[model samples]
Target: MTDTAVIELVEHAPAIGRPLPDAVGRALAASRIVDAAPDPYTAGQWVLRAGSKVGAVTLNVPDCAPVTVRIVPKVPIARLFFLLGYSLDSRGWRDEQVEVAEHRDLLPALAQAAERQIDRALRQGLLQGYRDAEETSLVVRGRIREAEQIRRHFGATLPVEIAYDEFTTDIPENRILRATVERLLRLPGVARDVRRRLLHQRARLADITPLVPGQALPEWHPTRLNSRYHQALHLARVVLTDSSPEHAAGALRIDGFLFNMNKLFEDFVTTALCEAYRGTDHSCRLQDPHHLDEARTIRMKPDFVLYGPDRCPHAVVDAKYKKEKPDGYPDADLYQMLAYCTALGLPEGHLVYAKGNAPHTAHQVRHAGTIIHQHALDLDQAPDGLLGEIRSLAHVIAADPPV
Candidate 1:
């Protein structure tokens, strides 16, 4: 293998086709950054990140510059790393099972967020251990062979299969979590302290098998009080099952993970708004379901619905990943917001979009005293600023009437 195959080019927050990393390998084997063709010998596509996102970029033959390689994520996808961290942190770090020294120096991005999460989860899982080491029947060197030997014993090797209970970290869930942590441990860029913690965690979980993808997510509960485990279980579930951390490369098996910006935007908005409305008259919901007719042939699902004290929709809101066009707002979005307001018999609806140069505007429908308001949130802003917008939006929604 060549240097290009062995070493992946590191790109830091570059725009698509704007800032290109040095071209090292032959045409297509250079860097993973996506760009225009005949330009440089780089990977087929670029690892373009607008915010804190990490994923594999899939490409067509046309997108390839005669030879394009794939990039991979060692742990979970880049998207979840920060959000998970923020979620855990927002709860006053109550989710932490073990004391993790803050990593102020580490890039608060993809690798750090994931390593911190996995390291803590694995450590906590070990401290509390599985609910029950469920008696596993195994053939090993032991004191006694409880079950009858199925085959004739070889010279001094009569260890028959026997069922026994033990407190071991070598379980399926631990194995999966262990493998993910080990993968991050092997990555070259992990910080010194973070890497130290991960190495220790890997040693702790050394006995667990490195399970492959598609294994069942084992069940776990927080039976112990001193150590919190729901967080650990959540972290394990994320690395094991989230959509962004998927493999697009087959034989080469390079990490090609992707986070859908549209979905991420919607989820973030819904979550922030939900958090703000806690202990209020309105309860925020995401993807609330609805039936269109008596037979239920048609279904209407809105992104966020503000349910009032009566448990009926007081107002409805939709999140859009794109900006308002310089010419006008998207007609389809307006129609959809109107339908939600009418269905719920509310006078107001809202459309939230990524911040653009356009000023915020509101549209008054022709009849039924219905109106739709539009607001734009800057995605690049700090999390507090973005959540502040959601808080403001929640206040507006609360002032609306139901039916």
Candidate 2:
């Protein structure tokens, strides 16, 4: 698709009166970057509505101009990065340290920050770690797999199966960094300078093993030996986790980088709340699983479940990233929180939204003796202000006694 043929749409806003080529429409539908439907008000026109996902994606079909659709998130690009960085590594990421000053868009800013972090991580040279390997070898190095040796060789002594630990730079940490660099190189909107730096990073990782496409990523543990890689790996994990690279849409080929704001909000809220409880008697569990019914048939997971020193749940919270409606925050959210409170046997529950139509409110369910509080966080505020809100909420949660 030509660079000039770009179509921009805001998150949760429908692009109306703009007729899309049938192929492009199909491509968008397949890419899942947005919801595409025929506009009822305008004949022969299409309506493309973006949901929680926000990023730039290019949808292509044969014999048509490729249409690059950019979905801008409701939150500012810098603030979105803060949410992402903090969620990925709460203690390491600082809003002022991210440095998205040069790039106003999400993709560029992310690419830049990722490249910088990766470069810093490699300044001291690639980290080396021990990796377990099992292979057929001419000679045993660590230990011989006698069972495998006999099964494959039928008692032949020429070759043997062996298991060993090899110390190498091609460990999970390097592989994750390499995969993230490769992912950034393939997508659009990366700055030319950033692309050069990413290429250099790739070269530094050239000897490392590339991650397999359909296989689970190799796991890495945090230790003092690889402490320098913590920040870079956190950013790399964020890039690798929240993106869709190449996927087919019938004849069209789609490539895009997207992030789900819903998940980002949830992760940030839950993680920051946990941080708030640090050094305190209370502990916070993220995505705490519990059954809603005594039969243990219906499972429920609350975003944040605060437990007291007695090891009992004191409060539960759910994070919601949504568009403000005309009347108020949806009642369905209140219902869900109520269910969590009832299931957790807590006196009250909380619902936090990115923004809300009305001020903070609470609902008391009659006869149930359960209260559900709805709180709206102003994400548009500075990071300090936003985090202050979380601290305030944490205090409120601690102040309430469990019934």
Candidate 3:
């Protein structure tokens, strides 16, 4: 096995085992982006298989030089960005804004894009907005908490507990920007220039309270006042979602940014479907929860459930993004969708998948009398065609007869 600092693999690459240094193999085995297993046919060889995650990560092995593992996605990089942006905000996202024609790697491209947007957001200076605050004040303010004063102060009049809204730059929007900048700085592969610019943004937002790592982010609403910050905030959320500094394999440290294609595809599909139903009488819920059994213990959540004007489930659909095998579509997915249809008391269910070897197909369960339809959405086409496919699916779903 040759010693190298980098290893490149494609998502769902063929299962051809390759030789690797023991330390590298161990480190790869510990990462979540791929599965590393010992090769049964070849001695001292290991197979690294990429799953739904795509991006680069640096694995630190004990006594060995750091190795960076880059998993390339099946879809084109530009399309991947489209999926991400559309998922963030379907109506506001403009793929032209995210320029990635020069970049091939996910981390550097993401870092560059994030830095540019953050810079644009801070160009006019930090945005100021009203934030609700609560504290004990010596002088009376907006409103006094009478119950708190009686319980904590025992009716004392010296200090009063008050709640008020104050206009300030230290709001959720700025804090999110700062936290995202900090996160980008920690990850490897960021261009030096981009890193420097992110630092500047952080300094501009230094006064804002930094979000605590691993805690829920502070809430912010969309309005005319904070319109300029919308684009930047959306990118910040994409960077922070499913990213953490705590990923570790015992003593070996793993630090990098990754996006789960499974989640991205699901979000884009469900959100697009919801958008298609915007003005229609039907309503859609993403991840609608239900129970499969009489006791209500076997809980299941379908990717999407369309509700009609009667406020009852009209259709059920699930999104799947996996490499299709030559044999046919996976039976397990059909089974799961069947379960969803049964639980929702619907006569039919739908399963959407990324384009694969198998085209759209349907299955009829014998005796169970349930029909499950499988649809494929080709992601390689232009955004208009991609969304057009979703619109067609929406029409079919809405027109389906209910049980």
lDDT of each: 0.55, 0.83, 0.86
Which candidate number has the best TM-score? 2
Candidate 3: tens digits of C-alpha lDDT, residues 74-112: 888888999999988899999988888678888888988
Clashing pairs in 2: none
Writing each residue's lDDT as its tens digit, candidate 2 over 1-403 gives 2553677788777554467777677667766778887777776677887888888877678888877777788778888989988888889777776788556577888888889889988999999888899999888799998899899999998788999999889899999999999988977778899999999999999998899875667788888998888888888887777466566746877766888888888999999999999999998888899999889999999999999999999999998886345456557777888889888889888888877533578888999879888888889899899999999999998888987
lDDT of 1 by residue, 1-403 (tens): 2222222322222334323332322222322333233334444433332322334332222222222223332222332344444443444333233232343212223345556556555553564343333232445533344344444344234445444455565655566567667655544345677778778777877777676565665554444542443455455444455543334343322233434445656766777778888888677778998765669776889998888888988888898866444356557788888878777778899888866623489989885678899888765555567567778878887887666
Best lDDT among the predictions, by candidate number: 3
For model 3, give the RMSD to the true fold: 3.3
In model 1, which runs have C-alpha deviations exceeding 4 angstroms? 5-84, 87-90, 93-108, 117-125, 130-166, 171-173, 183-200, 222-238, 248-252, 324-330, 357-359, 379-383
Candidate structures ordered by lDDT, highest first: 3, 2, 1
Cα error of candidate 2 at position 59, Å: 0.9
Candidate RMSDs in Å, in order, are 7.8, 2.4, 3.3
